[model samples]
Target: MLEILFEDDYYVAVNKPNGLLVHRTRIAEEKKEFALQILRDQLGYHLFTVHRLDRGTSGVLLFAKSSKVATLTVKAFEERQMEKLYYAIVRGYTPPEGTIDNPVKPDKDHKHKAPQDAITHYKQLGTVELAIPVGRYQTARYSLVQVVPETGRMHQIRKHFAHLRHYIVGDKRHGDWRHNKMFFDELQSPFLLLHAAMLGFEHPVTKQYMEVHAPVPQNMARLCTQFGWKDVLPAAVFPPASEAL
Candidate 1:
């Protein structure tokens, strides 16, 4: 069952697990389970998706309980009224903080078409070095980063990180195969390390600001523990509740 993070009369959010599709899609036809169907069945009511997370990503996923709420919530997302936070274990050490401003095409087929603007801001929370060597490096290095994408595009965070050459660990499509394999073999974790840790937006009906947080997945948390980062990582990713939205 999906973990319910927050729910109310008009909306519901879940701590989506990695490897679960948000809904049925032509890309992965063989998959039998989906978050949409599971949540609907579990709640005994139809829910409309306000946004989406990649199948490999786990974190706060919101759903509207009714069509009206869905429309309003979607508008909020499109207008950039919502703030989303993601945590990632990335290759190498990222800058203490930076922004990626690059335009992206929807797909390879649209390579010649005009690209849409994509921007992402990130902060390095912690770093770790492992004895395991990768590529030409004598030891492996990784950083935990808090990422906020200002403009949403298909795989924006993954693509931007790859562009910067700091690929997210376990990102198969746009990541370093060697690094991915290292995590799989050494850490016994093949799942993507990117997670949607928090979501903040205004209530459509009440117009009250609210924020919802989802705990890091066990696998990622374990990796943090192994890296001696269990304490600092969460403090950076999940800030104190007193921090205003």
Candidate 2:
């Protein structure tokens, strides 16, 4: 069943689980059902996607019941009126908080950069030191953080942070492979730690403010407990703000 976060006559929002595709793409045709199809089936109604979270990303994803509503919701996203908060376990202890403004574009063939106007606000959640016999060291350091991507671009958050050398854990393509394998095998990590934690925007039909939050996954919760972090995140996920245009 689709894990609905919030729902109303105008639209529906839900928590997208990891490894679930938002829709059918050429690369993942072999997959049976997608989040869209599953949501529609579970809701027993037609629904249109407002925005997308990556396949590996888990959290607040919205869909509209009507095409007209879908158009309006998508416009809100394009206008940057929606605020998204994400959580991830990063490679190491990152800076306290800062904005990353850098130009992003595809390289000659592959790989992209974080755009110049791109801004990502991040705050450290906590840190942990894990002991594992690897290389010349028997331990490694990691940091947890809450990230807010001010701009929505192709792989914006992933690319931007990767360039900062704070690669998101388990980001195979845009991440450090050696480290990924190390964590997955030694630490027994199932998938990436990056999660879509919150989403806020105006209700297109109601013309009212809307904010939604999804709790961290069980695996992440367990990891945090192992590190002695008991809900370091703020109780209030997305506070109301003026709609950005």
Candidate 3:
């Protein structure tokens, strides 16, 4: 079942799971399930998607209850009135804080695609070093970072991080295959580490400020615990004791 993080008369948000598509696409034509369809079925009503999350990324995804509401919310995003927060585990120990103002191609399908302006600000929340060795490195190192993208370009965070040479741990397309192999074989984590942790926007109906939060996946949470970085995660990421394992 999709975890509903926030809902109102005008909109609803869900904690979309990794590997789930926001909707059917030619790239993933063989896929059978989608977040939009599942949520529509779960609520027994129609939904209007305001944005999208990559199939390999998970976290707060919003939908409008109706067409009118969808229009309003979409405008907010275009105007940069919405705030998006993400959590990512990337290769190597990142600096305390940094910004990536690199440009990225809108899509990889086009050979001479025009690059769009993309900026990502990140703060390092934690770091860990493992004795495990891979490739030329004697040991492995990684950092937990909170990311806030100033622009909503497709694959912005992934591409920006790659430009910085700090690839996200499980990003198959733009990551270090060596580190990905190490994470899968040694850490038992084969899922993308990028997660949409939270979203902030004005209520389309109420015109009031609001924020929605999504808990990190259990695998991601487990890694934080092992790295002693659980304290850095927001309290909203944890469910009640009854819901926890």
Candidate 4:
């Protein structure tokens, strides 16, 4: 069953797991399972998607119960009325706090199209160094960061971090191969480290503000605990001590 985070008469939200598709797409035609189908069947009602999360991302995904509500929710997103918070572990230490203001293509195929404005604000939460050699460095360094994307663009966080040279761990498409291989071979963590931890928006029908939080997945939680970063994450999203690993 999907892990539900929030629900109401007009909308529903779930903690979408990594590797689950939101819906059918030409890129993943062979995939049989999707979050939309599973949640619709589980709730026994038709649902409408308001936004999308990448297949490798796990976190709060919201859906509207009706077409009208879906339209309103989508409008909220386009107007930048919704707030999203993401957590990630990257290959090197990031600035204590900084905003990455860069433009990115809409998608991989849009090379000829003008890039769209994309801004990402990030705050470093914790840092760790391991006595392990990979490439030229005799030690491996990483940081845990809380990220807020002011402008939602395709792969903006991943691409911006890549441009800054602090690639997100396990990001196969935009990361350092040696560091990714190190985590895979030594830490046994091959999943993308990016997670959508929270979503905040006003209810379209009720006009009341709502915030939904998705606990960090076990794989990511275990790594955070190992690095002593548990205290920096929101308490609501951290798993219990007994269940974290």
Q: State which candidate has the highest lDDT.
A: 4
Which ranges of candidate 3 are over 4 A from the true structure?
Answer: 239-245
Clashing pairs in 3: none
What does the lDDT come to for candidate 1? Answer: 0.90
Per-residue lDDT of model 2, residues 1-245, tens digit only? 97888988888888888889999987889999899999988978899988998888888899888999999888988888998899888887898887888766763455554334677888888898788654556777788888999888767788888989988888877887766888788767767888898898878777888898886666666666677665576544322221110
Who is ahead in TM-score, 1 or 3? 3
The sequence of per-residue lDDT tens digits that candidate 1 reaches over residues 61-126 is 999999999999999899999999999999999999999998876667557778899999999989
Relative to the unseen true structure, what is the C-alpha lDDT of residue 76 in candidate 3, on a scale of 0 to 100? 88
The predicted structure with the larger TM-score, 2 or 3, is: 3
Work out the TM-score per prediction: 0.93, 0.89, 0.96, 0.97
lDDT of each: 0.90, 0.80, 0.90, 0.91
Better of 2 and 4 by TM-score: 4
How do the residues 97-124 of candidate 4 rate in per-residue lDDT, one tens digit apiece? Answer: 9999988766666777898899999999
Q: For each of the candidates, give the backbone clash count.
A: 0, 8, 0, 0
Residue 240, candidate 4: alpha-carbon lDDT: 76
Query: Rank order by TM-score, top first?
Result: 4, 3, 1, 2
Query: Which of candidates 1 and 2 reaches a greater TM-score?
Result: 1
